[model samples]
Target: MVGVSSARDRISLRGIRVTAHHGVFDFEREQGQEFVIDVEARLDLAPAASGDELAATVHYGELAQEVADAVRNDPVDLIETVAERIAAVVLAHEAVEETTVTVHKPQAPIAVPFDDVAVTIVRGRA
Candidate 1:
């Protein structure tokens, strides 16, 4: 098991929209659709806050772009995989100790009407 950190500080980026080709069906892969991603990263903020330095903190705007890029990359069959990819990206930041990622598929291929479908994952450093 990985040792858990008790960090309370976090930076959350929500509702990041991206159009990507990812699904089980042929049409889904060929036509593509939109996906919404939410990411929450946990870290120690005291260094950045006390020093008032951008370098000490994770650049969220850059993070968002990286998340979007991950989503738009290689197509996968499950939103779970996408969520995992997003988590990996967030954890790549040296300051991020833990991350929770949510990948939302609003237009999922369900017979009945639904608002959305999503997969959420929480990851922490070892």
Candidate 2:
């Protein structure tokens, strides 16, 4: 684990879009849908930064892909669940000290016109 020396460093990614089939309705799984994910992580990486190693910090590219993969690969009932799951996934990285995740659904089948529906969650180490 990284020491307290390198505290409160953060990595953030915004507006990462992924096509997914996530909804409570059965037809949603059959027809599919689209989602946008935003992610941020706080990591302690003084050890890795001082040592100059790729292993020292969380890879944002890998994280973006992982978010996309998770959204596409899994079908769930709600965006809230997706956000929670993503928070857990990001915090699982050893370098990460805390994580925040947001899932957005723009094309929700609502009669009224609105920008989007979103869920945001924050998680950290025990």
Candidate 3:
């Protein structure tokens, strides 16, 4: 005989805005832009559920702080690269089984007015 049990795998955060100089053109970099970051993660919950400890699971607050830290410190030319970097950082955590990062850039230097430009990527432990 065998027994089946449920497990949880979800972590998410949203609306993290960071104003930074990130772009290809000199003017765009000088002027800066509004970046909105959204992050989601998935991991096994057995350790956390059993011990009620943070060390056993992915800490969403810490992940958000890391995202803010990366944007504030690094100067990248593209949101795609930003998303990739964020995903990499999240996946680096041993407890994180998978992660997704979305970086939104509004008020770009383009002549046209649009909602926003963004990139979303998903990464998993390999």
Candidate 4:
């Protein structure tokens, strides 16, 4: 097996778009909107690299589906909660040592004119 020295060596998935009901307001919840998600998983890659096998490392395609499912299937009131949930799901993979999840709410119910609203969280093994 190969070892990973730093979290910098990771598998990253970005701009996963999903329509879901998540917000603090009833209107926002009732009228689901688009959400963007980004995920980075840190794990050992030596085994996969040495063996030249897909099983040795994280399967990012499947991981992306899992993240999208988490966003679509679960409903929450805050983007923070969404980010946490995504992190938890990514961390659940046995190979993952640490993960960073970012949930973007472009259509947030803020009165001010802003480009975007997002929450990012990082979680790692204990």
Candidate 5:
């Protein structure tokens, strides 16, 4: 079925834009830039779907706030680290079995012209 959701479903939140200080260059760190994040969380949707209960699933509103806090609080030199941090936050939720995170540095300090620079990482429970 095209619209049917299975037990194993993915909830994705993309284009989470925020300004944070993170980069290898000193100037880049000092002058904060907008960072975009995309996150996908895979989990069992059966409970939430069947029960129609808020407690049965992860609250995306809380997740977004937490993700924003995760990016804003920590000052790291690499986007890879930021991605990892985000994955950690997603995995922190009990319902999430796995998570994929992408951190984009649109205003990256590069001499040559470029659209964007981003780092992606996947993490799951062990």
Candidate 6:
């Protein structure tokens, strides 16, 4: 199998929202909030492009569900952990040579008014 490179093709899923309990605060763990996930999988797309077959590429719908399940079912204290978990899930696919996962915590309990806080992680076969 080929490894990932800067110019590799990518399949991405963005703005996937899920409600999960993930924070350092007690209120955040108890009350749960919306978490947005974005994923980008990099790999050689020549086969899929020429074949025009679903099996030739990563199934994005299933990948999205996996990411959502990881966010909803697992309770972690940090968004960094969430991002790591998402990256693992995305890299599990055989066709995915590499993946970058971003976990967005929009409603985090911050004293200052901010738009959002997020963590991004990249993982794959080295």
Measured against the true structure, the TM-scores of the candidates, in listed sequence, are 0.94, 0.86, 0.86, 0.93, 0.92, 0.92
Backbone collisions counted per model: 0, 0, 0, 0, 0, 0
Candidate 2 per-residue lDDT over residues 15-104, each given as its tens digit: 988888888877877888889899989887676678888787888899888887878887888999888888877987887888889899
Name the better of 3 and 5 by lDDT.
Answer: 5
Score candidate 1 by TM-score against the native: 0.94
lDDT of 2: 0.84
| lDDT per residue as tens, model 6, 1-126 | 455453469999999999999999999999999999999999878787678988988888988999999999879899999898888888888888889889999999889999999988889887
> Given candidate 5, what's the lDDT at residue 33?
89
- Per-residue alpha-carbon lDDT of model 4 for 4-116, expressed as tens digits? 57555799999999999998889978889999999999987777788899998889999999899999986889989989889989988999999989999999988999999
Which of the predicted structures, 2 or 6, would earn the higher lDDT when compared with the native?
A: 6
Q: Among these predicted structures, which one has the highest TM-score?
A: 1
lDDT of each: 0.93, 0.84, 0.81, 0.89, 0.90, 0.89
Error (Å) of candidate 6 at residue 118 is: 0.6
Best model per lDDT: 1
lDDT of model number 1: 0.93
Task: List where candidate 5 sits over 4 angstroms from the true fold.
Answer: 1-8
Itemize residue pairs with steric clashes in candidate 2: none
Q: Candidate 1 — number of clashing residue pairs?
A: 0
- Give lDDT tens digits, candidate 1, residues 1-126: 334443878999999999999999999999999999999999987778778999999999999999999999999999999999999999999899999999999989999989999999999898
Q: Pick the winner on lDDT between candidates 3 and 6.
A: 6
RMSD of 6: 3.1
* Regions of model 4 farther than 4 Å from truth: 1-6
RMSD of 4: 1.9
Candidate 2 Cα RMSD after full superposition onto the native fold (Å): 3.0
Q: Which sections of candidate 2 miss by over 4 Å? A: 1-7
